[model samples]
Target: MAYVIDGDKCDAKITWLPVSGSLKTGELVELIQLVEEDDKLSREALALKDIFNDIIEEGLTYPQLGYHDESRFKSYYLSHAAFALRLANSGKVIGGFYIKPNFPGRCSHICNAGFIVDMAWRGKGAGRFMAEQYKLLAPELGYRASMFNLVFVSNQGSIHLWESLGFKKIGVVPQAGNLKGIGYQDALQFYFSFVKE
Candidate 1:
């Protein structure tokens, strides 16, 4: 089961300034937060669902074994602060992420986030762009730190991205993921702090 944050504990208002930049592929993209009432929610969600399902089918990044239906997608990705990366010209949703408290009550200050980039856009710097935005936005949402609970060790791109962004590998859970074809693989836990001690 996925981790769920208590509604009362994490009341941080989620909002951010949209940012635009060019990808390595030379496409300009804009990062915008997705609110429930936004007119683009349905359309964006449809595209994102396909991208998310493709990743899940690959069994490399996310842990979900089966495809995510609309309800499941909303509950998992849209429960809290969500953002999407869209082409500046076409407004096509190519990637997105969600942020929520890793735990409830006293631990609510520490946030956890999940990200997905459309397969076609992979390796073109979309992931890095989203990670950079996440670093800025997480703190703005009142999170003091961020943690990724189950990053598969085989995911070199993600491992590199997190490390380059100053997220420290705090621990590793052996045989944490029963990935497709590869069987069980270790998962790495990463943490980054917004507040310096």
Candidate 2:
């Protein structure tokens, strides 16, 4: 995948190898910022609110799973996720994503991913650019298939994009999402096989 890197802003390129402590700190901050902004998108509002309340805010308050700690961030990428960052033309973080093996043992061939574009940069094609980049990186990351576990049904824009990229809705979980005024709604599962030719 071709990445537009801001040399002054991002000091590192996309690499699976872990970074030094200070650089890792930079990455986490950027990733969190992306997720925070993503929380406001119509498609992500509900799920992000739930996560913010149940995990980020609540768990941190109770010291459950060290939610407030940075080590948890490091450990997540090291153990379960292959995280990446995309810097803006100005060198600030514009987007980031994590692609991971969906399951253990026999199911390890499937990959799952989560991505977000900076709220300030949304609708400018950042999300699309990041996704296109991920498609090229998937095989190198060792994934033969890619799946999105919980796409909000209302996120038709994203649905169209993913469909254009060859993903298909394989199933839906009814009333699985709590949309503010709408109460609850179904969530769609999308999948794509990326087996290299």
Best by lDDT: 1
- For model 1, give the 10-residue run with minimal summed lDDT: 7-16
Q: List ranges where model 1 is wrong by over 4 Å.
A: 8-16, 38-41
lDDT of each: 0.87, 0.52
Residues 1-197 of candidate 1: C-alpha lDDT, one tens digit per residue: 54557654234555445889999989999998776664334787778888999999999878888988887887788778888899999999999998888988788999999999998899999999999999998888888999998999889999999999999999999999999889899999999999978
RMSD of each: 2.1, 12.2
Model 2 lDDT tens row, 93-184? 44456666666556766777766545554566655655766687666656689888677676676787798888889999887766544556
Which pairs clash inside model 1?
A: none
Error of 2 at 48 (Å): 14
TM-score of 2: 0.61
